[model samples]
Target chain A: MQASNAMAALALAVGASLALAAGSAGAAPPALDEQLDGAAPVISVPWNVDAAGTAAQAETLLAPTAWAEWSNVLGIDLRPGGSGMEFTSNPDYGTFWCSNGSSPAYAYARMHLPHGSTIRFFRMWGQDLSASGDVMAKLRETCLPNVGPAATPTVTDLATLQSSGSSGSFTVTSSPDHVVDNHQCAYVAYVQFPSCDATTSLRKLRVQYER
Target chain B: MTRTPFIAAVFACAFLSSASDAADFPNRDFRVITGVDGKPARSDDSYSYASGNYRCTNASTRATPHVVRYPFNLPEGTSVRYVSVYGRRTSDATPITLRLRQVCQSQSASDPTSTVLATRTPAGNADGYFISAMEFSPSPNTLDCRAWVEASFDISTTACDASKAWIQRVLLETEPSDRIFRGTFSVNVDYTLP
Candidate 1:
């Protein structure tokens, strides 16, 4: 009986050890916030002077551009403006529009990241023609995996800023759950008058990330 | 008695280990296209295409093309087994063709070389929105696969032309105030990771 009891205890020990091994193997790496001793700049997307150009121009400037700060992960090509709008640049900010008495317009910027990287937060500054008391604006993120049907896209609402009743500036910061899968690319869309007959514009936008 | 209990413990341990490994595989979603306002002249009085919608063309047009391409990539050791495409059109009976191709390294994502793997023409949903799916079982599975989609629709003046038919993304909008139509295209892929 004593020998049998010893064998049972040994089996229990073996099982427990195996469980621990499996647990460690499957555990996710430490999050970006936990990895740094102090705040360190990992990735930055500046939609300012450098990114300030016509959508047609942006298509060339943004494509195959390397994020020098990160391990040189190549950003994907940016398409020209969407169907309804035109990209315009100004001294203070870059903007796109459907103009007054014009049809609704849409525009977006997209990028590809290195596998397993995550976006911690995103920041943007913009406003709609609602200051003219005419329209409103909305921002959303569409994330897609590397492999799948092109027809289906995952859309997430980032923010919705009503017309300030004047051309005032609005800024927004994203929450942490906005993760990008290691196997997918990310698309950030700035929509003006989504339903049509409204006008909006964006002055500045930035995205911060970690490897 | 001792042998039986020991064997059971070993089996339990094995099962747990396999489960943990399977949990590491990642699943993701992507929007290849969003909704855009249909062509102005194609707008029908009954169905307002002025809002953000996509219009189909008889042949490729300067405004709305008959064929559109979207590019995507897969991680090493991962294979896609199934794809689900969701779209909505102004007309219910329009027919659309979807083709999957292997992208050559030399070609851009927007332009792929001639290596077509699968093609299907799903029947449109008379109800306006349709969800079509395709399953794939490649003979020799490959890792690090780069792929793209070539989607086209028939152009019948009376049936599926600019005036009668349009396509849009399938999105649930909570706010009616938003007017911009981000062209909508969604594809759900079932993948297995090594």
Candidate 2:
């Protein structure tokens, strides 16, 4: 019995030591290359509601293009740029500032890069609305005014482009004509709305990406 | 020096050692989750689907062209070869595609640098619903691939075939996505290699 007890004790001691050694050796597991690499860049297109009965109608019209899950939401954060982003923490329908009849709303999205990937820009094309007339779309960086006042962002800075139209209602679309920066490890995309109201709205945004 | 005592001791020791190792193993369940919500008023455009064709629903709370992230863990051996993805659209029947493989070779543990393995589309269908399959091996060296369905459903499909999107938010499959759901959900699929 003593021999058995002694052997058991020795085994326990060895096992415990092995476990401890392993626990200590492993610092932290590195992050994985899951979806970011292949996943498309995040694109935020603030819906422009300018048509007659547009705000309510656009929702039903673009139901299919709507986000389906929590994961589909754009991930956006304030970057380290000279000018920062501005949004309401508890916005009823996004941060509202510009007027289309009611408060204009915007959407934010976020994505992660491989820490050192360079993003080459491409030409941007968008329509005023999904079921549109003349193409009307633009892109921009952060929505401004710090929830107070904004510079009425345009495609020049944020790449916001106003689609040409014979009618008044239009959808804006745009992307970087220049290079896009991959800050640290995060990449943010913002869709701003200066007058994405009842007369004009934004829809369908795509970013052509390259390695 | 008795043979019986020695044999019994050896057997007993072997059993106890194995039991300890098994206990140390990741025998418990774990989960994987990922997603996004940047622009609110943009309308919900993104969607999610799981194995056995389980779809995620978007309440009228959030909007679209969003970001999504899911976290899932795996045991020593897990395969990541194939997964499926589904999307919806409205009057615009364009597809929002998702790829299944990574672009770069990476370390065995976690690979966040490898690019997505699938292509993006403006449309979604069963033809669009496949994931690549590889040898089932998740170890300490070779990185298992991760996938992403770049965009979400279309406005046309969501309105007309909204039922399809509704019956299941849509489809997004990974061969061993089981790596994530195995421990947590009631998933009992075989991962043993044939």
Candidate 3:
């Protein structure tokens, strides 16, 4: 009975979210050149946590201790009798990394949202291994104005996970502008690994946007 | 008697849906890349953006051969035919290699494997930047749904100096299809019966 009720609730939540996305007022939908009357399109970008751009930094942070755990950076235990990406401090002291600190871990996927589509939401599937640790995920947009020799780009946090649920999505409260403006400004989606502890594995990060 | 009719109905609905989906879309041009969409592969790579143009500055010997990748965000199974990149080099002799590659990553989060589908070397035009394009034969070359697509910029041969290599845009002309799905899908089915 609980399983059935949970499934039904999930379906309802999805339906509500879609309706909300479809109703958001913003730019006109791009012309579907081939399908004159087809439904608006949606683009989904999925990234593995290992795809994070700051992986080089993460490896540095994890350091030789991580090396002793896993043979490779991907956290695979190729070495004989080696544990796979597990970390347990000898003194059991608390450490906050990944999503915090001066360099947060972020995996970037190029955004090609049709010129006028609206960003809907972001979803992540991962596990927080430590009982006191947090595995937070958020979607960030970094945009650079197209009319400069080189200038500081803008970064905006579009959406963030509301809870520790295995699978969760939060609506974007910021502007729904999903245009790929080559002449004005360009945008890229960066899925952030805001907070994570040892043994935390992020299987996937997905961004959904509608045309 | 009821089970047989129910199975027949399911099949009929699926067939109709497939037929209608095919009829709705016709082959059309789809552009997925612009110069501004590219991101530097390495943190140390030097890049500049200006008026829809992306410039890779080979300023440091340590940062020579900058690689900027423009990832494709089109639907899975989309067919691509023509690809063009417009750009100019500060020095007419600067060399750049543009590659169309399909990259596949296994579920184990291991190293992503890639295959070069096409390669185009843009020629330096005396009159600033011109379009360098390649048309694939047996056209409508379908993209792999299980892999990611990207246009890789390789400026390995370019001189390592303050000189700049600029790219205005990268365009892909694709045929519109009914398969509008996005992202990679991994499905496992069990056939063992109880």
Candidate 4:
């Protein structure tokens, strides 16, 4: 009964929010009224968040120690398409630093953390989900593994981004362009349950914006 | 025996009523699951059919700023009454300040020479090192609507800087008020058009 009620309440909240968003459609910014008369803004962008074999090999998966900090950073609803964007549209280039997990803990950034401790593919930008961005990517194993002891998962920043160039910069004055970040957690069957931890993590991703 | 039809009628009525209750707009935002594959020639990918109020947040190392031009298809003459900016930090981090600006695009952000529609500096917002405006000018054809945030953290104060930015996903609950901007942990609003 509680679960059903919770689900119903959640449904209502989403409905309300969407209704709020589902207004007259294409409500142009007041400042643009004087500029754009009647034309659709172009929307096009590319993404890049591929992690090349650098995940940590672990036996169990527990929330990262820095989960609070990570969650705080990702939980706050920034902007719709994305928040605090670090890329320059004109230059279409930028970089960010991602270091290893401060501790052996992890978090599901408002988004889903991959299953089996894997950080799988995650969307870096989207009007669809900027609201829930901190959830770890590809983590379906919600219940922490039960073993003699649980090992905290760790994350390490493998590289420094020089530029985040979009694949195809189709100017989008209305929509959003996003990049995905990949984090991988290794699972050790031989080690036993509650031993899952992050194996490889890609800290920063870069995308280009262009014609 | 003869009451079977009556029961069926009642059941149908109940179902319809329940559906109506669920069909409301603010009731539940439509969440269309989307995915991207190789290309047109490719077979394309398979995203599960999802029914959620919102989409998942994009993961990034830095707190990225994303601005989406809204209402992709509003009939011509769709004059906007107001515009607002809503934000919230996904993490447990407290006080993730957000700054909303309404500056002229043609005007220079570098030179600070453009005319601002409604600067949040005087309002509940601040004029950070990096602040852009949401394109709401009279011209609908102009590709101008935009928003930005200073995302880096202050080494000394340990606060989020609006000047620095990232390319992560951002969610919008509503819009922002003309006089009010910058949310603590999270924010939502309807917007100011006048």
Number of the predicted model whose TM-score against the real structure is largest: 3
Ranking of models by TM-score: 3, 1, 2, 4
Model 1 ranges off by over 4 Å? A1-78, A81-109, A114-211, B1-65, B88-93, B106-112, B136-145, B156-194
TM-score of each: 0.32, 0.29, 0.42, 0.23
Per residue, candidate 4 scores C-alpha lDDT tens digits across B1-194 of: 99999999999999989888745433112111111100010001111112211111222223333322121111122333223333223232212333332222221111111223333321223321222234334432212222222222212222332222111222222222211212211111112110
lDDT of each: 0.37, 0.31, 0.40, 0.23
Comparing 2 with 3 on lDDT, the higher-scoring candidate is 3
Which digits, one per residue and each the tens of the lDDT, describe model 1 over residues B1-194?
77999999999999989988755422322233333421122111112343555555444323332444333432212234444445554444455666655533110111113456677776644555665555433421111123444455544433455544554532211111111211110011112110
**Position B136, candidate 3: lDDT:** 42
Instruction: Write down the DockQ of candidate 3.
Output: 0.02
Show the lowest summed lDDT stretch of 10 residues, model 3 chain B.
B185-194
Residue-level lDDT of model 1, residues A101-186, one tens digit each, is: 33454445443334454454443444443534423333455667566577577777655434343333343434343455545544
Report lDDT (Cα) of residue B34, candidate 2.
24
DockQ category of candidate 3: incorrect
Q: Which scores better on TM-score, 1 or 4?
A: 1
Worst 10 residues of 1 chain B by lDDT: B181-190
- Chain B global fold similarity (TM-score) for predicted model 3 against the true chain B: 0.59
- Candidate 3: deviation at residue A156, Å? 13
Task: Report how far residue A84 has shifted in candidate 1, in Å.
Answer: 10
Q: Write the residue-wise lDDT of candidate 2 on A1-211 in tens digits.
A: 9999999999999887655433321222233212122233443223333434142111111111111111111111212111122332111111122232222344443432222222332122122332232322233333333344556632234454454443444333222433334331223444444443333322223333322
Residue B56's lDDT within candidate 4 is 18
| Interface DockQ of candidate 1 | 0.02
